[model samples]
Target: GGPAKGEGQATGGCPVYSHPAQLTDNRNCVLCMTCLKACPHRSVEFNLRPPGIELWTTHQPMGHEVALLFLLWGAVLVHRLPEIAERLQLPQLLARFDYHALATVVLLAAPGGVAWGLYQLNRLGNPCLQGRPFVQVAYGWLPMVLLSSLAHYLTLGLTEAGRIIPVTLATFGLATAGPIWVAHPAVIAFLQAVSLLLGALLSILLIQRIAQQPWLRLLPLHGMTVGMTVCLYQLIV
Candidate 1:
C-alpha cells in the first residue's frame, strides 16, 4: 500500500447496518419487521440518507389574500378621492374644478389605509413576518396616518368656529382645555404611546391566526376600523 495509507481507518461518517444493534441505541431493538409495521406514530424510520422532508409542510398557501388587500386599499383611496383621475398632475385633466378637498382626504387616509392593508396582506401570505417586523411597521405607520388625519380635522375645526379659546397664562385658565392651545405634552405622549402599542399587538394577533387558517381572513374588520375612525373624526369636527 501507499505510505501510511493502511494506518488510517475509513470511517465514512455514515451509519453502518452490518448488525441490528448498530442501527439503534436500545439493545432490545430486535431485528423484527413487526415493530416497523405495527407502529402508527412513525417515530422510527429507516433513512439510509437524510432527505429534504424538513423543507416542506402540508399547509396550504394563501397569497391571494395579500393581493385582495392591495386591491381593497386601492379602491378605498380611489373612492375617498373620486377626483384622483383628474388631479394626478395631468395637464389636460387639471382644467376641471379644484381637487384640493379630495386630495386632502386621500393624503390623510391613504397612508394608514395602505399600511394596514399591506400588513394584512403580508400576514395573509408570509408566516415568517408574523412577529417583530409586523409590529414595527404597523405601529410606525398607523399612528402617523391617524394623528395626521386628526390634524387635518383640527384645521377644519378651527375654520368652522372662530377661536373659541382665549389666551391666558394662569394654570387654572380654561383656555388650555381647547384646541386653541395644545394639550399638556405628557398627556399627548401617553395617548400616542398607548395607541401605537395597541395597534401593533392587535395586528400581530390577527396575523398569527391568519397563519393558521388563511381562508378565515376577511377585510370587513379592517374596513370597519378605517370607517370608524373616519366617523369619529366626523363627530369631532
Candidate 2:
C-alpha cells in the first residue's frame, strides 16, 4: 500500500525512528514498522542502543549533527540567561525586547561560530583532508560542551528531578521505602567543579589530537571555554 496509516499493528513498539518515545505523538505510532520498511532509498535504519554513543566516537562529516547540537546548546544558554544576567547584575541593553528573547535571537543569528572554529582547527591539523573540517572536529569537542552543561545544571536537576520519582509513586498510590536522596550543596559543588575541570581538560585534549599542539589556535578556544566555565561556576553554582 502507498500509505501505512491504516496498516496492521507492529509487533512491539514504534520503530518509527531511533527515539519514538521522545516524540510528541509517539502514542499515535501504533508500533507500525511501515516507515522502516517503506523507504524506497533504504535510508531508514534502527539503533536499539543508547543515544549519543556515536557522538562519543569518531564519525565523518557530521555537519548536520553538529548543527543540531549547537542549536540545542544555544537553547540551553538561552534558558539560563535570566539567572546569569541576574547574577551578573547586567543592565537591560534592549529596552523594547525581553532579554531572553534577545538572547534567543542572537542564538538563531550566529549559531555556527563553534563549527567555524572547529573548521579552522582542522585546517591547521590536517592539510590533506579535502572535506570541510568543521563537523568532523566539532564532534571531538562535544564531550567538553556536554559535560559543562551537566555541571551547570547538576544542582538544580538533582533537587528538582529527584522529586519526580516520589511524585509518580504518590500519583499511582504507591509508596517509597526510603526517603529520596538529595545531594548536599557542598557535594554538588564538588561534582560541578570536577565536571567543569574535566570538560576543560577534555577540550584541550581534543584540540591537541586534532592539531598535535597548535597552541596559538587553541588559546582562544581554551580561554573561552574556561571563561564560560568560571562564569557559570560563579553565577549558578
Candidate 3:
C-alpha cells in the first residue's frame, strides 16, 4: 500500500531501529490479541488496550481502576456536607467559633479525601491504574486517615476559642463552640470518619447493586440507621 503523505511516515524525532523492517513505531501495532495472550506478566488485556497492538512496561494497570472506585465512593463524603451543615446548624453557628480554622480544616480534609481514595485504590491493586506504584498505598492514605482521626479536634479548637474570648452574651459566650465539643464530640471529632464509613458502605452497596446481591441492600441501610441512631443520641444528650 502506498503511504499517504503525513500519515504512515514517522516524524518529529522518531527513532529508527535497524532490525527487521517492523515499523518500530509505537502506534503501528494492532491489538490483535496476539501479544496479550503471549505476555508472561499477564499485564495486557483487550479491555484496556487500544484496537491494535501495544506494549507497556511497568504498567501499573490497577492504578486507574482503583482511583475511579475510590473517587466514586468518595463522592459520598462531600454529598453529606449540606445535610451535616443543616443538621448541625453550621451556618448560624459559624459566628460562634473560629471559622478560620474550621474552614482551613475542611480545605485540608478535601484534599486528604482525594489522597486517601488514591491510596486505597493503590492498595487494592491500583484498581483504577493511577500510575503510582502499588507499594505506596499506605503513604497515600496516611494523611486522610490521620486527619480524619483528628476531625474531632476541630471541636476542641472551637471550644478553646470560645473560652479565650471574653465576650459573654454577645456570643453564645464560650458555649458557641460547645455544641461541637459536647454534641457527640466523638462523632464530631472525626467527621471524615463518618465520611469514610458512609463512603465505604456506599461503595459496597454499589457493587452489590450491580451484582444484585440481596445482602448488599442492607449495608447502606444499616449505616444510615446507625448514623441516625447516633444523631438521636447526640440530640438527646
Which candidate ranks first by TM-score, i.e. highest?
2
**Mind giving the per-residue lDDT tens digits that candidate 3 earns over 37-142?**
3334434433555421221222223455445533432333343444556676777434445663464456435533544554454336524333333322212232
What candidate 2 gets wrong by more than 4 Å, as runs, is 1-58, 88-98, 107-111, 114-132, 169-178
Q: Across residues 16-116, which tens digit of lDDT does each residue of candidate 2 receive? A: 44443355433346665664554434455665864344333433444577787666656656666677566667657233377757766675434357547
Please write out the lDDT profile of model 1 over residues 154-228, one tens digit for every residue.
Answer: 433444343344433224465454545444545544454444344434444443343333433434334444454
TM-score of each: 0.25, 0.60, 0.24
- Weakest 10 consecutive residues, lDDT, candidate 1? 50-59
Pairs with backbone N, CA or C atoms under 3 Å apart (clashes), candidate 2 = none
Off by over 4 Å in 1: 1-97, 108-183, 210-237
Cα lDDT listed for each candidate: 0.41, 0.61, 0.39
Lowest summed lDDT across 10 adjacent residues in model 2 is found at 1-10
TM-score of candidate 1 versus the correct structure, residues matched by position: 0.25
- How high is the lDDT of residue 27 in model 3? 39
Ranking by lDDT: 2, 1, 3
Best by lDDT: 2
